[model samples]
Target: MRKGDTILFETPPAIAEFAAVGGKRESEGPLAARFDLLFEENTLGQETWEQSESQLQRHCLDLALQKANLAAAQLDLILAGDLENQCTASAYTLREVDVPFAGLYGACSTMAEALGLAACLAAAGFVGHAAAMTSSHFCAAERQFRTPLVYGGKRAPTAQWTATAAGCCILAGKGQGPFVKSVTFGRVRDYEIKDINNMGAAMAPAAAETILRHCADTKRTPGDFDAVFTGDLGIVGTRLLKEILEKEGLKLDNHQDCGLLLYDIDTQDVQAGGSGAGCSASVLCAHVLPALRAGKLKKVLFLSTGALMSQITFLQGESIPGVAHLVELASEKEGQA
Candidate 1:
């Protein structure tokens, strides 16, 4: 397998800076203080949800550049993605910016996928500096994935609330802060669960497979990390992942889910918890990165999970497929020190 699915970067690219922006609903969450910008209106001063999502991307880009103290022209490339079909939000975002951009789609796993690619590019010396970012909007996702807002249909307990937010990070050739040590790209796993409403169940197998592969390839264990975070598994998915890992004779000491951490599940009425691409992206940018930078977290794993399903496939009675990607981040070489 040649080091397997995990890619160890020789140069070890580091995140120079990052930024996270959220919408009104997300701003009301427990991690509200971490956000760089929160919009009072979901429109983001725009007329539609799609436009608003694009603005969210733009907001993250501007804030990221400001935090890094770098200009737009200085970025070698920008990698971005979103939940909209055809990557509409990311496409519009790139159109307005002059930097070279690559659009990505991994459902909710976009953030980890994009960051892994960006880190690899920088680590390989192909790019000196690159921007990796992603975003999601509740209104836009629901309208496309399920029913229209006007329908006002009841949601199941397993349903997750898509976060309306954006997260962007700048990867440099060399710097401090949370640095990428390795990235494990996941393979598609379909467990044959066809309920479109149950996203956590759809994505759990993929998450488990990737984590197991990464640990086996790197010779690391759950206790080796300060925290292991999954993208948007919510309450249900978290429990499922734990069970799957245990059956494989692996156990996690400090495991967390971006979906569960984003909001108060009991009080927020967020069914299982938060989902969507931006949920993990925004949470990591606002909370996780800060912890890494502050030395509170010595080593962490950001595993983004995605459900590879579409309206057409769902209508055709096809089961949902899933994928996950993992990025290992360390706090500025603390273990070696």
Candidate 2:
């Protein structure tokens, strides 16, 4: 039933195909080969980081469409976003691709946000096929959010490296497998966290909010799903979320963070691990979806977390606002029919 902010899709939409493309650094990570394709260079043949960001989105979309035996023109709608100002990276990427486009921005949570909206539209018979995608570039994000790359200032230990990657997933009114059963859109949350360096802390409450809210709204427990995946909360935020959930008497038995899973904490020296819209996007498409397809996972809750802070807001000493969007994915063999 379409009630409140969450939509329970009676005819759950299935992912037809998905593609995750990453930069060189991401390719060297634990889920290395899980990525559909990897660019050996961060430029991706683009002359600028912003252009590279656009290219990343295009690459993922093209690959996803190719895998699904479809073309850019075949998609009924494209819901996508990125961290760039105005979401220009995603907008410019699909500007000429010729599909009905909708630009979204949930920061890192865009992956779930885009997917949930697409699933709802598709499942409701509003579209025959839809594509959800997002991308981010470390250099581009750093330039926009922080300091100059050439400045080379010391990065705080609490900081997370923005992932340079992109992921795309296609959904149809009906498809083969890995269906989206529900969506719980998050409300903006503020913990009054002022440290721009500590995004995990800023976003953890929102993640906790969406998770518990999804449980309360759906009448399910943490044990109901085989896995619960949160967006880029890294180590610190993951711990904070656990504590918050524990205080509420709901222990997350099977939970992991895309940020923590993206990089090697010990060897990579990525500080708190990876964050950005692409972190969850790439990981979900490349790793989690594959596991679901393989029957290794049955039911899963995917939460993409985002920080809603702007440079101006941060400069003005305002607190960071956080958000998280949730979607339930189930293996095709096990999805409600």
Candidate 3:
């Protein structure tokens, strides 16, 4: 059922299995041990960076299916997305898989968006099993969005590193716990911040708006959730998000950002932090969902933010618009509510 800007599922879909794969850099990060697979090099035996990204998605989905003890043919649907142009990485990755596929492009918010749609379909009895996955590769994103590695472009301090990682989660109509309870889709919020290097500032407003809407629609406060995670809002965006929420009389004491948690900023060269579709997707699969399943957390809010801008739009001097999608997850005990 619909409640204001949020959709509350009568029968929440359970996350049956999930997997995370990362590149060399991510393997050295704080949550490296949590990943299901870590490639020594960014290229997973692929000739090109784009092909490597496709390999990331394929491997992540395969691992998830293996963990679930199911084959691709058992899935009713597959929703996938990536940072590559036209979402080609996801398209190429799933070409061999026979499952029906839907390509999404919410930029960094693709994971949350995909998971929300998958949950809704399962709860409505449209599908017995669905998979939600997304990926991003640093080399591929750099080549597409910025200058090539050969250019030696200087990055701004506010710039975030695009993580070379992928994550996938299989959702079923019936399973043991970590249920998707509700979803809140965000509105496009353009703050006229045209600096392409600072994605956090461009996306912060949208994250704040969606978070507030979710809380309002659900008649809950930030304290109600065991933890609230934002997609790729690095240090800069995370601070901005908190400031925006604070003005509305909401204090996020339990807040954590996927970008910040994925790497050790003090040691790593990632300016602000991590940013990409894979940033949150990988962290969610590697860390958050596991905690929920282990009974270490109860109710949690996962909001993935995205900056909707194209190279053409950037060159045209058009302002970037940001969007965030929220998915509410609860433990099996709380799922009973």
Candidate 4:
């Protein structure tokens, strides 16, 4: 994270490739429609983590730049990453695009970090435009970081299915148009939980810690913002986060704090909570952006939480490393000084 970064951009614009809830092609399997939404196909045979995740991010970014009507050369940086270890997917996808880049590692918090970086750069007058992008593939990430395809290990009720998707947003300086207003980074916390199956429990404390810090740093009350959203903590983690926050003397109202679990899917069973880089990306791209445009929400605080652990660490009896990053999104136009 940078030392000094403030909001100077007007407002940021985002885009995604998935029908979170309903679409004309709901009958198609999730994989097929996901590809169709991104204007790609499974030409590489079975879905490889590298191919699909990279494709979705690349296409989504192209669309984002197009929407913003800016050429690739205009961007000073392309901050991108994903949940995969070492961020292989986001790195590979960024290679194909044209921009100076910084690879980030925060699992689900990748996108938030990227946005924060861009906002900081723009505010510091380091660049006029920068883009933040991230993508996740259920198959690729699971096969590599957690379990193999053949394992098929039984998932506990606390498991959250990784969502397969990608999201991109264009953050421009005052010259580039409306963009991010402000970004806050969370301190990484060490939680001794090592079991991967119970990720929600492991990550909850981190969320709680960050939520309190964000409220304090911004000097804002819970009721001041329309909603406070967490990236993926699902059911179990969300409850734990709220509980921990209140215990710390910070009260988060029910409607005020919303968790991006299961996206817009209810019938779909998400065990502990939704977990993935795509979980927060998809929800923000689909619901939050539209809600902001519709004037349904005024200020939104998006806090993306991640469990910073690897299968190797867990196997070696290492404790899980968890982190969360916060980005403040507001629908109202900037107030002139």
| Backbone atom clashes (below 3 Å) for every candidate | 0, 0, 0, 5
Error of 1 at 189 (Å): 0.3
* Better candidate by TM-score, 3 or 4: 3
Q: Residues 15-78, candidate 2: write the lDDT tens digits.
A: 9999999998898899888898998999989899999999999889999999999978889999
The estimated TM-scores of all candidates read 0.98, 0.98, 0.98, 0.84
Clashing pairs in 2: none
Q: Write the per-residue lDDT of candidate 4 for residues 153-180, one digit (tens) a residue.
A: 8778877767666667766555322234
Model-by-model lDDT, in order? 0.92, 0.92, 0.94, 0.65
lDDT for model 2 comes to: 0.92
What candidate 1 gets wrong by more than 4 Å, as runs, is: 334-337
Q: Write the per-residue lDDT of candidate 3 for residues 60-150, one digit (tens) a residue.
A: 9999999999999999999999999999999999999999999999999999999999999988889988999999999999989888989
Q: What is the lDDT of candidate 3?
A: 0.94
Name the regions of candidate 2 deviating beyond 4 angstroms: 333-337
